[model samples]
Target: MRVSSYVIGAPLSDERFYLLLHGIRGTLDKVPARTGAFLVENRGKPLVSPPWDSDDRARAHLTERGYLTDLPEENERQLLVEVATALHDAALALRPPSFFFVPAYTCNLRCPYCFQPHEMHAGRGVYAKIMSHEQVDDAFRVIDHFDRPGALAEHLDLSQEGQGTADSGSVRRGALGLFGGEPLQEQTRDVIGHIARRAAERGATLRAVTNAVQLDLFTDLLGPDGLAELQITLDGMSDLHDRRRVGPRFRKTFQRIVDNIDLALARGARVMVRVNVDRSNADELARMNAFFLERGWGSHRAFSAEAAVVTGDAGRETLVTRPELVEVLDTIRADQESCLASYEGYAHGVLSRALSGRYPFTQVANCGAETGMLMFDPRGDVYSCWDEVGFAEHRVGTYHGGTLHLDHEAARAWLSRFPGAIDQCSRCPYALIHTSGCAKQARDNTGSLFAAACEGFQSYFPRTLATIYEQVESCLLGEAERPGPRPPTRTLPIVDVTHGRTRPPRDEVLR
Candidate 1:
C-alpha cells in the first residue's frame, strides 16, 4: 500500500495516505474508494497495484501468492519487487520532521509531578549548567547541518535505497523548544532572546513549553511574523492550583501567568494549556475549564486544552490506584464536555491515537514505541516519553563530541524493553485497541512492559473497565448524577526539601 503526494498537507482529506499496510487486518474495507481510485487513475502515481479489488486486497494477494510459490526464484523475486515498490512509494510520500531542543532546562515551579524537577534544585540540577552561548551555537550548527540539502540527501540515502530525494522545501524546519529549569529565569532570558533572534535570522519558528510565570518578559521575543507556540501549565483553579504548584505567592503567580498568556495571545502568539491531572486537582479541572471559557480565552487562534497523566511522585504507589485515576479522568471529561463542545480539548493518551489511525481509549496488547513521541533533552539524551527522565539506558544519545543521532539499532534497543505481548493482555480483547500500557511506567515500576501491562491489567484495568461499565449502565438508567460538592479545598503541607521528607497533608502547601 502507498500514499499519494496530495495527501502530504491534508492527510485526513486525502484518504489514500491510510493505505499503508502495517500488518493490520480489514483496513482496505475502511479506506475511502475516492482516494484509492484517484491514486489508481493518476497516470504519474508511483504506486504499483496488483490485480486485486483494493490496496489491502492487493497486499494480501501478493503475500499469499509469494508464500504459496514453490522456489526462491518465483516466490522471493515477486515478493521483493512488491515490497520494493511499496517502500519506494512510501518514501516519496514520507515527511520527516526537523525538531530542535533549545538549550535551557530551568523551571520556576517545583511541582511534585514534573519529571525534570531535578533541574530546579540549587545543587542537583537535572540538566547541566544553563546552555552557554557556545552550546547555543552548537545547537544552531546541528540544526543548520540538518537543514542543509546534503544532510537531507544523506538521510534519504540512509533511509531508503535512493528511492526519493529530500529538498529544502520538503524539510519542515522550526525553532527548537524553549526548555529550562525555568525558561523565563533571569539567567535564561538572554538565551531565549538569543534563540528568538537566531530563529528570525534563519527563518525558523519558536516553540517552547513553560510554566508561564515569566511569559510577559518574552513577548518582545515572539514579535510579529515569527512562528511561535507556547505550552503553559495550569493544573486547576487558583485555590487548587496553588496547593499543588506550591509557589511563594500562589494567587499572584497564577494571575501573572494569566496576564502574560493574554498578552501573548493579543500579540498573535499561539498558546496551549497543559493541565497535569492528579488525584488532588482532577475534580477542579472542570472549574478550570469554566474559568477559561468565561474569560473568552477559548476562542483564541492557538487555544487548546491538553491533559497528561502525572508522572514522578504523583504516579507513586500510594497516591491513587489506576482505577481512581480513571474515575478522576471521567469526572474531568464529563465536566469539560460542555466547554469542549464549544472549544478544543485533548487527552494526551487519547490524542495520540486520535491523531494516528490507532483507536483512542481502547486497550492494546502491544504496539511499537515508534508510534509515540520522543522527548529530547538538552544534553542530547533521547527518552521514549517525557516521563522516563531518570532511566539511564533510555538515554538515546549525547551531544558531546559531535551531533548524536538515533539510528534503527538504538530505536530497536529502546523498543525491546517493552514486552509486545503477554497472556493476560492478549486474552483481554482491549489489548490491541489500548496499546498495552505506558512502557516507561511499566519499566520503572515492574522492570518490564509485559509485567507492567499484566499488573496494570489486574490492578487498574478492572477499574477502567468497571468505570466504562458503570457509565454505560448510567446511560441506560438515564443521565448520571453529577459528583458531589467540590471537596473542601485543602492546603498541601510543604515538605521541607532540605530534610527530604514529606509533611502531612495540610489545608495548603503555603501558609
Candidate 2:
C-alpha cells in the first residue's frame, strides 16, 4: 500500500495543533501537527508513509481520511493519468446553463490598469458595435444543440429532490450572463434588453457585469425580468476612482456609480461591487467597505463585494503578496455590520467554493475554460474562455450560420494541456487541487501556458484553511447569525498614497 501522491500537507501558519490536508478542490481535511513530527521522526516521507500500525493514533486517523491507499508506486502516475482523462471527458460532456456573450468590447472607462490590451478596448477609431439580435439568436441556437451538462444545476437549478424545474433544468437556464466592455452603455441597452427578455421568457436568469454609470438609464431592466445582480466596480471614492478609471466619456462616474448602486439596492436588485486594489487605493479599501456598511448595503441579501488585487503586465504594481490582500479583507470583516467576515471574502470563496463543488482534481486541467464552456465575442468569434476572447491566436472556433465550427485539434489542445505536460505543474506540492491557475496569465507573463502560475494561492493557503476551520467551528458552536449595523461613518481624512505610483520592490515572503 502507498500513500496517494496527490494528498498535500500544508502547515497552518499560526496553528500549532493541526496541519491541513487539501484532499481535493472541494474537500479539506486536517490531522494533528504531531502527525508531521511523527512521520519525520520515523523518516517516513509522503507517498511512502508508514502503515496504520495499531499503536499509532495518527496513522489510524490518516487511514480513515483516505490518506493511505493500497496503490503500487510504479502504477501511480499511470493511475493519475487515467483519472485526469476521466475528469477532462466529464467537463467536456456539458455546457454551462448560460453563455457569457460580449455584446461589444467597448467600455466607458479605459482603466489605466486594465488587463486587456488597447486593441480589445473601444475608442481606437473603431465604432462600439453591439451584438445584433440575429447574432444573439444564432448564439442560443448553437447553445441549444450542444450537449448541456449538469454543471448549470450547481447554481441555477433552484430545485430540490422531487421539485420541478424548467426544462432548461433551471428555475431559469440559470442566467444568460451579459458581459462586455460595458453592457449597460446607452447604445447597448437595446441589445441587453432583448437578451434579458428572452431569458425571462424561458424562466432563466439574467445577469450583467457593468460599470453602473448608466444604470439609471436602464432601471426598467433591473427587476424580475432583468438582471438579478449587476456586477460593477468602484476602485475608491471619486478622486481615487476617476484618476485611475480615466475617461472623458464618463464624467463624475464615481458618484454616479454610487448613486446607481443605491438605486439598484432600493429597487430590490442585488449589486456586486468589485473593488480592485493596488498601491493607488489600498489604504481606502477598508474605508470604502465601511462606507458600504454605513449605507446598510453591506447587510443586503444581494450585495456582494469582492476585493481583488489588481494584476498587470509588470508585477511591480500588482499585489506583492496574497497576505497583503488578506490584510485589507481582515479590516473589512472586522466591520460588525458587514457579512464579509462570514463569507471570508466575496463571491466564490471558501464556503461558497466548497458548496459550489469542483472536479475532484483528476489531472492538470484548471478551470471551466479548459472545459467546454463557450464564449462568443463580437465579430462572430468563439473562445473556450473569456480571457482568450480578444486574442485572435486563442480563438478556438468561430460562430456562423447558427452553428459552432470549433477547430478539433485546437480545442483538444486545451483539454490535453494536462498536468504531466508541464513539470512545473506535476511537481507542485498541491498540484492536485491547484491544478492550473490561469494558463493564459502564465502564457502572457512567461510566454508559456504550461508555466507555473501559482497566483500566491499556496502562500495564503494556510490562513484560508484556518478561516474555513473557524467557520465550521462557529457553526458547530451554534453561534447565532452575527449580522449587525455598524457605526456611522466618521470624518476620516484620506491619506495620499498615489505619488509617482512607482511600486516598491515586491516582498519575497510570498511567491
lDDT values of the candidates?
Answer: 0.45, 0.57
Q: TM-score of each candidate?
A: 0.59, 0.77
Identify the candidate with maximal TM-score.
Answer: 2
Q: Give the 10-residue window scoring lowest on summed lDDT in candidate 2.
A: 502-511
Q: Scored by Cα lDDT, where does model 1 land?
A: 0.45
For model 2, the superposed segments whose C-alpha errors exceed 4 Å read 1-4, 10-16, 22-30, 37-54, 68-84, 94-98, 118-120, 125-128, 150-172, 331-338, 341-365, 415-423, 426-429, 446-451, 478-511
Give the top-scoring candidate (lDDT): 2
Error of 2 at 439 (Å): 2.0
lDDT of 1 by residue, 179-260 (tens): 4445665567776677777777777777665677867766677634553666667767776677666543333466777888
Cα lDDT tens digits for candidate 2, 1-511: 4455545454544455554453332344555565643432332234443433544676666556555555553355555555554554444333333366778887777777765655556735432456898888888777665525533232322223443323453232565666666667877788887877776776665667677888998888776456766767788877888887666577567888899998888877767676666777888776777787788887676676655565645346555344577755656565534533211221113334444464434334555455445677767888765556666788878898798877766665554555555666654545555555666666767987667667676656555556555555555678754232222121110111111111100110000
